[model samples]
Target: MSKPISMSRRKWAAAWAVLCAAGLALTAALDASSARDQQPEKSVSAECDKYIADIETQLAKAKQEGTEDGVVALAGVHAGPENDDCSDAFRDRFGGDE
Candidate 1:
């Protein structure tokens, strides 16, 4: 029983819907970019075995201390030695945290 919408009004409504969708998409993209920028990337150049070994050591220590969060809350290392330097330089470049 209601009156039908005019062509202009329908077009306006469609345009409004499109604008809203675009706004939402833009907002989502900005949010994603912000999140990516906020988090520091973990880039360890050390061998995979060594990297995992360090994590395992942290896990073991956390387990002993009854604090699982310890390992889970570890900050990712941004810079690390690419190759294993087992000589005297090893201690200087690589930390002995593990």
Candidate 2:
């Protein structure tokens, strides 16, 4: 006659399969989240570009004719480590209000 299988062994095998499936699911979720987080911040940069452009155009016009409007534009121009003033001015002149 054949011997019967042990209950403890069967339970352990089931538990192990469940744990592995859970681990795989967790890994996939984390990878998806990381990918989402890596997307470039394009909108914020685009808005800032518009502001910078306005300032630059004003500066250029001021250079050409020394007008008060140019001076005001210069005041509104964003100047710092993160923006290009000249490009910003060009964008502003082309209608980048935000």
Candidate 3:
């Protein structure tokens, strides 16, 4: 008669399979989480580009007016709103403010 396989070998094989499945699940979860984090960065970058483009368009319009007052007004607009780094950078770049 043939002998049955040992219980220890059967248990070991089952445990190995379970461990591999758990590892694969963890890896997939981490990859999905990472993908989610990157989406916001991409959207913010697109929004920043839009803001810059709008500013440039306004500057061009102001330039076409061809008056000192118009230029000064455009400079004020370019300085942007108060209490923001974007405005600060705009002022610094165009020599509007500190």
Best by lDDT: 2
Writing each residue's lDDT as its tens digit, candidate 2 over 17-90 gives: 99999999999999999999894633336656665566666667777885635335244545675656444445
lDDT tens digits, residue span 1-98, model 3: 99987678879999999999999999999999998878332122344445657766766776777632443333333333432555544454566531
Each model's lDDT comes to 0.62, 0.65, 0.60
Off by over 4 Å in 2: 1-7, 41-98
> 17-57, model 1: which lDDT tens digit per residue?
99999999999999999998884634443554465567677
Error of 1 at 96 (Å): 32
Deviation (Å) of 40 in candidate 1: 2.6
Per-prediction CA RMSD (Å):
10.9, 12.9, 12.1
Alpha-carbon error at 97 in model 1, in Å? 32
How do the candidates rank by TM-score, highest first?
Answer: 2, 3, 1
TM-score of 1: 0.34
The TM-score of predicted model 3 comes to 0.35
